[model samples]
Target: MVEERADAGLYGPDSVTWRIHGNQSMALAGFRALSLQAVHPLVMAGFNDNTVWFDDMWGRLQRTGDWVATVTYGTTAEAEKAGRVLRRIHAALPPGVEPESGLPYRVDDPELLRWVHVTETESFLSTYRRCGGILRPGEGDQYVDEMRASAELVGLERHTVPASEADIEDYYAYVRPQLRVSQVARRNTLKFMLPPMPRWVRLGTPARPAWAGMVGLGLAMLPPWARRLYGLPGLPTTDLLATANGYAVRRVLSTVPLVITSNPAYGRALRRTRGPVAA
Candidate 1:
């Protein structure tokens, strides 16, 4: 077992990642990242073969959100434990076969792991910036640098992962030739993301509009290449509209009560940072 530390897991309160990820608006970033990841055939193969995400999207989302929250805000021991569990799970899974290439893929494959890390980090940082999360000059790159340790925990090589914003952009450019929309990607984009509203949030209700707007914002936040892959508009005007919508949502969510927005893991980290309360 990893030893517990009083300090925050990987990023302290002052870190750019903590500030960017703590905002509720980053939820859209996660959505955008998933869409981006799905374009990789090998990644989709791994998800299709090993997970029930297609059948239970909400459950997958909740589990993913919990893992991200824990790693981002849990103490050192907690984060290491989570990492170990993930590594073990990945190791135990059978090799996935890419439908197009007929080549076997492993969950712990360094290249595949690098793809996941790059897409997620790029999406999160881009969305956070677009949503008005403030970052000092070079802090965005610093966030990428800081995430190297997190990526290593999940079987990515530090040297293979992008270490700066420019590196991320170049990596995406280099990998663009290998990315294309697959049937699985299309199904996930349409079903999980913009599914018909549940009966509970009936049409014409106040909650319906908010729910619809959130889904729309998620679609709009997809990168241009991803949008094109999904047959969505990639015009500059569309980009502008998406940016405006994301900013609006960010502004509104920023006002949400802290008690409602803050996760339990974050609370524990805060307590650790501030030390125990006096009787």
Candidate 2:
């Protein structure tokens, strides 16, 4: 087992990112981020060509989740190791042409990396706030500033990544003209947000409602602009409904036992904060 190193990671317990990332509401944010990411042709092309997500969605989720957990809560050494592994994988991706624009695509392209970092960070923070995670004045800016360190681990230049909440919005405005819902984006949105049920789950009526509810909730959490790009409702009421539903789900999840909701890295971080486990 990796040794727990309290306050030895990138952000430590006091960072705004640590608190927001530890909340269960981040799962919803993660889905929103993926949806937003799919709208970028280069990002989607790279993902389609480079990943095995189509064949093993759960495996991809697990692997990505593990990386995020480690970087967010693990010791400094563990986070560094995870970063090195990711950098190696990115470096080795074969150059490919984006099908939509015929533009060359490289996994390690700094611009592309910055896009992913900004979109993901914005989504995570947005979701955290929407779900009632409180933030102090300037904490949102601090969260973005702190996340730049993690972005650097994956080949993004610290300067290229936004370092404040205002900067994040500015970056999004600058990039908005470049985003569109291509066929890849539409296909991926459907696959990820409303995946086909397995035979067992399909045969069982009881599971279907719950699955649909979750899918609807995820779709509802998407930004209005993203929804508009995908031809979804972009009305204010739509956002209100999504927010209300998200809060309800967050409330329910808050009741889950920590052992069930907390992944290993988060659990370790919690223990560290609490000053070690009792015998």
Candidate 3:
């Protein structure tokens, strides 16, 4: 348990960053971000060459979540420490060439890092708004502007990350030609959506399907253009259907008791700012 302190960290309780990242819909947004990230060939190549995601998928997800939560809600010192560690790790990873582009890349490549940041920021904000979480006028841009700090943490140039919805859309349009659903992309993307389960659990219980259903809600969170890049046939009512299901999923997940669902870093920050706010 984190005791009370005066520090409010990078984004305080009153920030739009907190307003969005603190929402339950963030779980869904994470899955959506992964799927979106895989669309970039260089990103797929980086993951394929540098990570052991296939061998320890659950650990990969947990680490990703922990890093994001720490940087978002940990004390300023803690957040900066996490950033330094990430930079060191990225710097040590060996470089590789993307198969499609025949170009060498680093995990710390500014362009690739920018892509990851924009996609995640877009995914989180879009999920929060789409799933019925409220944001006052222009908070969307504020959230995007705020995320530039996170982008910097992951080795992106502070000025390079998109800072508004229009800039983000422009970035997507510029990068669209480079996005495609390759065989490797498909394989890696499926790993996030359908995680490995024990044989007995798969056969005897609804666990896999139930979990997949939640991930499906994340897929539905994808932008229509992304779905098209993945070759989804745009049915007339898919958006309507998906939006309804997204509302249900958000409501259910939101109802999980705070004691059970609170992120540790967020809980600590709450105590620091508001004196034992988390149960």
Number of the predicted model whose TM-score against the real structure is largest: 3
Q: What lDDT score goes with residue 102 in model 1?
A: 86
Q: What are the per-model C-alpha RMSD values against the true structure?
A: 3.6, 3.5, 3.6
Worst 10 residues of 3 by lDDT: 231-240
Ranking by TM-score: 3, 2, 1
Q: How many clashes does each candidate structure show, in the order listed?
A: 0, 0, 0
Rank order (by lDDT, best first)? 3, 2, 1
- Positional deviation of 242 in candidate 1, in angstroms? 0.8
**What would the per-residue lDDT of candidate 2 be over residues 1-279, giving only the tens digit for each residue?**
444444548878778878988998888888788878888899999999988787888788889898889999887888889999999999999988888889998989988999899989998998888888889899999999999989988977788789898998798889989888888878876677555668787786656666557666766787788788888999999999898888887899899997887667877776776664333
TM-scores vs. true structure, each candidate: 0.90, 0.91, 0.92
lDDT (10s digit) by residue, model 1, range 1-279: 444536667887878878777877777788778878988888888888899876677787888988888888887787789889999999999987887778799988887888999989988998888887788899999999988878977877688888999999899899888888888777766666455557776655666566556666777787787788778898888888888888888888778887887676767777787664333
Candidate 1: list runs displaced more than 4 Å. Answer: 1-5, 194-198, 202-212, 276-279
| 10 residues in a row with least lDDT, candidate 2 | 1-10
**Best candidate, lDDT:** 3
TM-score of 3: 0.92
Better of 1 and 2 by lDDT: 2
Off by over 4 Å in 2: 1-7, 196-198, 205-209, 273-279
